[model samples]
Target: MTDAVDPPAERLLHDLGITEPGEIDVEVIACAVGAVVRYRRLGVGDARIVGLGDRAIITVDNRASRVRQRFSVAHELGHWHHHRGRRLICHGAADQQVGVAGCEREADGYAADLLMPRFMLEPLVAGVPMSFDLVYQTAAAFGVSAMAAALRLADVHPAAFALVVEEADGRRWFRRSASLNPRWFVRSAASGVSVTADRYGLSRANATFAAPAQRWFLGQGAKDAQAFQTIDVMVCGRAIHLIVVA
Candidate 1:
């Protein structure tokens, strides 16, 4: 998302003089915003927030990874800021997808903004090309999942690319940069034979290759596809491709 989208999160960072990624202490920030963060084994959701007036308590799942815990805290903080006076239980990132409720998406956006504000993330990805290395690096630096970093990078990075996640069952979804042509719909894993599918489980040292636009695109975009390339890498047994316009 753009820097202008959420003013409260950005304003909070500004008020606290938080200019660096490591400075974003979600617990501390939550406390500053009248919320107390707690950790426990949550059986129902990743996190939950209960608010009374200005003060609130955020409970996160302790069994989750540190990055996940951080995101849960930030997400509850989002609900605390936007949906105060109401109790909420969030399942996880899957609930943050497009078709979910507006409130959930809003909270997700808030969490993203709070965790990886554009002001901080932009500079990190300023001139870097999108790749698994860049995504993993950003994830490490920001204490977020590679998926989150990839989506955020696609949002702020000045490149026309897409981060595609293909499941073992061949299901797929993607997040594309704004500069990517609107017509460039990614081809489904089952619809066509692709080098990416064939190259999985291989070393990533020379994974980057020039492939025909038709190899990745479909319909109008495929017909008018520009010179493009892909960097396919196996991330946690899932096929991840960084499709970049060449």
Candidate 2:
């Protein structure tokens, strides 16, 4: 039998009377969901959820940044609400890909929506130029990491925007805005080199420049070989490249 489905994050936030675009107190939301929040020195990951009788205990990594702690707490609460009775350990951006694991993806989606509600984010990003400055502003307003803010913008913005994140070891993941055509696949260089990698080599933390679409996408026809503007931002030692295609 199929598992019972929980409500989406939007409905959950609405039911909790959260309609504004600002910092969401995930601790308060956890209490409302009957989960206890605690802090401990977790190993490398963000947090874990353990089912205790009818309630759950969420233990967050004390050493993580404040924004990561917030997202971790919200992700554990997602487990409480969606996958009850299953103990879950969550890694932050390290495991947040499109389709690596089902539960992790669901919980990440829940955390993203709960933290940055689309209804609120849509209006906030409307007419704003797609740039790292806008992403930093949004992250400050929403109390989420700059990476999270960039991902949210790529998810909801009406324009064709794409965000690619690369780790120190050359591993990468990417997400594109709704208006972007699905056929476009981001290309990885022979040695995992990318625009963000080049910027990192120069010790640049933030930059905006123009490059041919082929620099990012693979198999681009002449018709699609236009110039694309890229905004690169370094967050917590990871490279976040935001590409705006015209």
Candidate 3:
């Protein structure tokens, strides 16, 4: 099993005196870490970090959503904390490209931890039934996007759950909770369209239902297993699916 990487991020939040589900002021954290944050109308990427000795400058695209901007700021801060003296450019949700670099994924994980500290999120999700409403509520509580909250929940939820973020062009990314068996593999159509995609196309927003596990997983166990609850939401033309095993 792989080790979790949220401890350092949690420690940073601890040092910042943030111990609850509330707004995480990324700008303040950047300044505290000796970085200057500037908002610009960036054309190529959502954000980037440029280092100069002990200090750095973080440039964020002003065109992105407020929540996206917050995550971008936190992502740059992660780079500063973990990969000092290295410059990075981050593409936002609007640019849904497949495949993320190791450093980029690590920075995203750190940002998720920093924005939604495990200490606070664990208790909030404990014993709570899984649903799109729950994810949205958690997102509101943490002042993050629903997709971000869903991804965090997949990492922390005690149950066997998986969160899949699929783009319109068929490329996708998924995260599974530790409880899920390592051999399980999620299934996706060649065209990237599924029942969830159909619902998303109709509503272009909220949709939740239950489907056979084989609809998403092709393994023998998944084919014979019972149904799983699927909650989906559309974000920036991407379909985010939250599947909870029964």
The whole-model lDDT of each prediction reads: 0.74, 0.72, 0.73
Better of 1 and 2 by lDDT: 1
Native-to-model Cα distance after best TM-score fit, residue 111 in candidate 3, in Å: 0.6
lDDT score, candidate 3: 0.73
TM-score of model 1 relative to the true fold?
Answer: 0.85
**Model 3: worst 10 consecutive residues (lDDT sum):** 89-98
Candidate 2 structure quality by residue, lDDT tens digits, 22-76: 5378888888788888999977777888887778788888988888888888777
Counting only residues 3 or more apart in sequence or on different chains, how many pairs clash (N, Cα, C under 3 Å) in candidate 3?
A: 0
Off by over 4 Å in 3: 1-6, 87-98, 190-208
State the TM-score for model 3.
Answer: 0.85
How many clashes (backbone N, Cα, C below 3 Å) per candidate?
0, 0, 0
Candidate ranking under TM-score, highest first, comes to 3, 1, 2
Taking the tens digit of each residue's C-alpha lDDT, what string does model 3 give over 1-246?
124554777877778887776647888878878998899999877888889888989899998888888888888877888889665445543221226666777788778888888888888888997777888888888878877787788778788777777777767777677677668787544123454465656454455566777666666588676555554645656677777778
Lowest lDDT 10-residue stretch of candidate 1: 91-100
Tens-place lDDT per residue, model 1, 1-246, is 453555688889989999899999999999899999888988887888778888988888889888878888887877888888765555754423434577788888888888888888887888787677787888899998766677777777888777667666666777678887787776654235664555655655335777666666665656555544444444445566777766
RMSD of each: 3.0, 4.5, 3.4
